[model samples]
Target: MTDTDNVSRRRFLQATGGAASAVALAGCTGGDDSDTETTTTDSGGDSKERNLKITWRPLDTLDPVASTDSASGWVIQQVNDTLANYKNGAVEIESRLATDWSIEDNTKYTFTLAKDAKFHNGKKVTAQDVVYSFERLAASDSSRRASFILNDLGVKHETKTVTKDGEEVEEYKPNSLAVNAEDEHTVSIELSEPFHASLPMLAYTSFSVIPEGIIGDVGDYEGEMSQKKFAKQPVGAGPFKFDQWQQDTKAVVKRFDDYHGKVPEVAGVHWQLISDDTARYTYQMNKNADMFNIPTSKFDPNKVSVEKTDDMGRKHGTYGPVRNGDTVNFGRVGGISNHYVGFNCEKVDKKVRQAFAYALNQETVSNNIFKGRSKPAQHFTPPAIFPGGASGYDEHAKKYPYDSSKAQLQKAKELMKEAGYGKDKKLDITLTTYDANVYIEISKLLRDKLASAYMNISVEPVKFPTLVNRGRNGKLEVYTLGWLMDYPAPDNFLKLLYPPKTDTSKKGMASYVNWSGTEAAKKATEAWDKIQANTKPTEEAQKARNEAYLTMEEANWEDAVMIPLDHPYEDRMSYDWIDVPMFGGAGRSRQMLNTAKFTGKRN
Candidate 1:
């Protein structure tokens, strides 16, 4: 798990101009980029018992609130439903549990739930369920407190003093509930202040609507309610109902026959957790697994053979490596999907952090390692990811280009010296990531690039969950991560670093990025506050937010808090049998889980 697992779900989206990786279908290697034609029509519409296949690194939890990783989000998507959702490659706020929704005076958002929607246990999806799902998030021990409760909805993070041993310490928690049920079918979310991007925030699985009857009022990340019964066996108004879960093995979700939304044609979905990349690809190659992303080795030089090449000079596995059959290539699913190197501000000082940022060249990584599959990003979040930011939006990426120039590198070396790191007094540190082939290659690159510049680094690969666990403790000195957007707004990117951990239990909170109390964080928060005050999603709001971020990001670059990597173009291949309804790269990672069906005849 990268920091996105940490959202450092980058706990994850990128908005930028990027190309999709070319897909070589079996030995055929046909079709231009982004033209696999998977989304032309809906597959599995014939109403049959076809099992939808998916691959993952295993789910952390089905408890939507506590589950921070994308794998967990995928599972939650099938088992639960949000008030609103982003479907069909757009963020249009389609009605789900809520039949209709409206905004009043830019402060109150009202959603009317459908009368027919029911949970797996036959409970009707009501306004009380909606209110309970939200209040539950603000409970005593919820990891999602900052993400949805405090940050997005705009509320106070209030704390009360309590006695610990003899001394009294502050027991901080989110000041919650502008969320209430106006009536049984109607749910209203009233923010203390105007939050322009509130609806988009509801589209995230983290803000998923769960049954109040099961979890109850005070949500628990541990113990009986959230984890024991609900996390493993969930009940929601989604297209699928939870069938069974065997951690690290598989999770089975069966189609709900009486779903309010379009019922999936498939009888069920098989979420198989394939840990090994080679084994995962092997399943795809033999068509044993219906879908999986193209292996990092196909694009990364580390695992890819040099001899494999297509006529267009692109690599095809059949040229040397084994080729998978008739794969569908859907290029560059939109939004921000950037990979970055984040410094543990507690251990790495400002000067050393800046030096580390300027030490390497993104072009080398973009051209060679990524093989033009991903754009080498220069900012933490891609500007185009935000609403009203497609054209004429100012970005901080240009300020710090991929300059491995002697002047810049020299400045970096000087900073390294200033930080008391040189040949005699070296800054020794270890960078950790999950044991994925792609991440291993990335860590290796960072280690070599930083070592060449004077920051002596050792790459340490751990399990995905462990990487996220270690991130919370600030054990990693310099770690590699990419943030995936929870929603298609600048707030999603900005909020990833917002809600600075100010309390004693801050280390325990996953949102604690180790950059709290820094001048950089203060400035970023100030700019974000200005952005939040804009009242509505408009061109003026986007520009104001963009300009404010420009100042924030410039300071961030100088502070060297996070080194921007490219928002690489993501490319993926599915079998011709696969029908990918939403293909916005990482954004649609979980959205298409319910609607996606396998219609093509299997041999």
Candidate 2:
């Protein structure tokens, strides 16, 4: 399989703006400029650098920690630069004010400052600046980007009693938190324990280092600084700097004169927020947007480069280019995401869930609706995250093929009959989904198929915000949602459905609320806890961890908590002027600053 076919899920979300927290309106095509045609060569820098009109949905916020939308991320992709970034196959630590580093231990690391790395304000980036940037992230009240950093410093949240002077004070203290500036050029971070996810955590845009002076200059930086301010006017040590933001319309970034790395090829970057897929596609067609994502329906092979590959050794059917003559590139969108149908464990019975699962026609959805955009899935855990995941799942496929009118349906009917969900006793179920044409179609299709088994399936279309709230509140009967992995690893996926029982857990996004509270699943979650708790587990530890992941998946799936569907692929269109390798994680490609060069094409 080509990189496009066996697309790593990590890169897929980055392409589609995996951080999207809500729906946004697509950009309205500005009045056509056909009246004023100026001819110029398409070569980079041959003409004056014009404002780049990249299209995406508007973001909710720009606060690194709080903003989860792709629009916000695309903007941040320009203004902010991370300490270590993923590029060309590995995590390359940029010399963004920091030239080098030394790891004292698993819990302790020290970075050497780059004398020339300066902020947009022309202030020299110091070890103290790095320390301040981290402190703000740790104490911020917005989102939880701080927790990732604190965890990197081996700081665990623990409730404890301490004696201050002569009195005893009981409180919760963040464990092993200490940052010391050894000198003007070096800083050290001491942690309580070793954590594995640290490097990847730093890859997050939220952890991008900011000017220390900016924080103190603006008192109460966390409370006062809004994403609007950040998006409209941002300051960072990246190759590019923020210029202006037009709030849901567009934003601009110019090259930073003092950028420490190899200077960027382009002079400036611009963004046009477009929520509607068709509008975004049209912008690309009209040559307004240099790059934009397209849906499976409008995917045109004739437009761009396409390839097919088999990354997963298993027999996942060929997912690209039916004919080389077709111009549109076809393949899968990667990242750890599962398009699974989840049942409200509290409301749905096991028999009912299994019956519904059996009756659901995933092949039809994959073939007709998805248009071969996705592969039919059988397991809850996807192949990309878990090691040997494809191998383990290949065994299950022999037992279950895509068959809608077979013993599986018969079994479902028998289960429904036993559970009193038949012609005389139909169970009322409301399947909730957000406003996506594909998802809406899936819900309607399932509703029609379930009618064969005489089950009442009500299709409820809710707003995106309400959809998220309903899943978090555990109030929906059935819900359709997708999980794009934040990072590569089984832990990220496992943590979702298996958050701690307390309200303070991180798995709020998990749709299988029933399995999370169940005794067997809880036990599986505890086993995962033990694995993460280890200071430095041996190879055996990881092997055991993969085994645990399967245990968790089986525990949840056997209980009919969630049903796997398909892994959907996205179609992206870009003018030849926009050049970036399309086979990496989300952050790697599409960032205007990362591409060697991008030029506007006028046809």
Candidate 3:
């Protein structure tokens, strides 16, 4: 039977719990009649209230160039307009301001503008604005948002041009970081060589052109944009306009009447910053909100407006009905995101790292804690993102196995003995986790496994801010973090971990990953340099990336750096009124929102 015909709304909710990455069950029953009803309410002019309650934290900033963090990006995504965007498993090339473009040469791209596109302030978006935004990002060394753009295209430092080549072949002024605008409507982006992913690179929200007048006045834009006043109160050219922002509470957005494309279906969108999962689920259960995920404790398929369930959970959990509601299953997981538990390489012993790996059982952890809500992640990329991806690298094969037994226990004990920790000795370590039951379970499993090897593990639940600072400062023993791909390219994940640079150029965000400065990391960094210098996106570059990834992975393991673990399954629930594109991450896929016409009715 067709998906709509057999799948019950309750069954779907019970199985996936509105998780975008949850596994889909087959032959379930329950239709999304609620969503239909909600959409009908909106389209039929029942009420103009378009409020969406989400379980995400508040945004950090509003500036497109400054808001590189997920929270900030979430807000700016609605308020700012990029030159291009990714959605629906494809990058839909639309005329934000620049309608079309032509590759003038390997190093140059010229874009033609659409006269109609205008900023929310009523000023026309011009080439000058584009050049200004880029230049501003380049000038600020702290601006991580500009790395993708600046790295793809060559940047000039004071009185010298930093070529992609090993040789610094130029003498220039300090204005080197600036993008030169050739004309009002047309501009040329010149690089030392052709970067294959430049087009998609431009599609990032960071590349969204801003008003030239704003940045030209801001003095010494050298620090994090999130700290900038402009980022706190920014202007943009998007379908929505920034209204007001109350930190730790909410960010209000009003529909832009002068939006160039199709006007928004609802009058306004209320992005409520609700951090408590229980609270969000409670609201969803009570119908206070038309649709949302049901909390783990409160999830019930029978009480919901719809029902859908299938066998995706049985394969992992080995129990429960074939389906459930508003739950992220432990087994069925896809989409290109990778989540790994990493260890500290600087302070931990190599043998201890391997022992930890051997002690951890991904399958057991997946089934028990995740409840079939995630997949066993092996690498940075998933099979869905590339060819042979699911089966691509054999790196994990080189290390520990999930088979825990008496023999395995002896081996782990032996390793600990060699590492100077045995029955009489113990290693003290702090493991970091976000304040979540899911992570708590993972932490406990890790602690138990490590304890088997005579390691004294302590769980430290740090606030999100403290966690970010500690991770960036390289001040943790072991921390669990998830890496979601910014784009559909390997470079997005690979390069961000170790970007290329010149001997004179200052260090950048890649330092966050290579905090140890080991010889292997240095080599991987060199490989990144070579990849950047390469002219084409050929097999040679791919091979180089593969080599870099292997070297980095090995170094991380050998040095007892971050221990990589299995990726958990993710899921998303939709209110009957909302039609989120079933392609990738909710906001990551730009196309998901492209065809979403909000109906006035409540589903």
Top lDDT prediction, candidate number: 1
Which run of 10 residues does model 3 get worst, by summed lDDT? 23-32
Say which candidate scores most in TM-score: 1
Expressed as tens digits, the lDDT of each residue in 29-66 for candidate 1 is 11111112122223434524566666666777787777
TM-score for candidate 2, please give it.
0.77
Which of 1 and 2 is the better model by TM-score? 1
lDDT tens readout by residue for model 3, 1-603:
344323332342243243222212210001122221122233453333453334445565676665545666756766777666553433333346566665534455666665677887888888877776776666544355656655654542345567655765543343464356677787767666666566556767777777775644334444332335667777888777777776765665666778776656554444555556666555554444432333443433333222333322212211122132333222122445555566555556668767776676666655556655556544544433332244444434434243422125567778898989976889998888865566777888878877878999999876555665676666766777666555545566656445232111334454233334667557656756665666364567666655655555554444444444555444445445554434333233243232344444543
* TM-score of each model, in listed order: 0.81, 0.77, 0.77
TM-score for candidate 1, please give it.
0.81
lDDT of 3 at 259: 76
What does the lDDT come to for candidate 2? 0.56
Decide which is better by TM-score, 1 or 3: 1
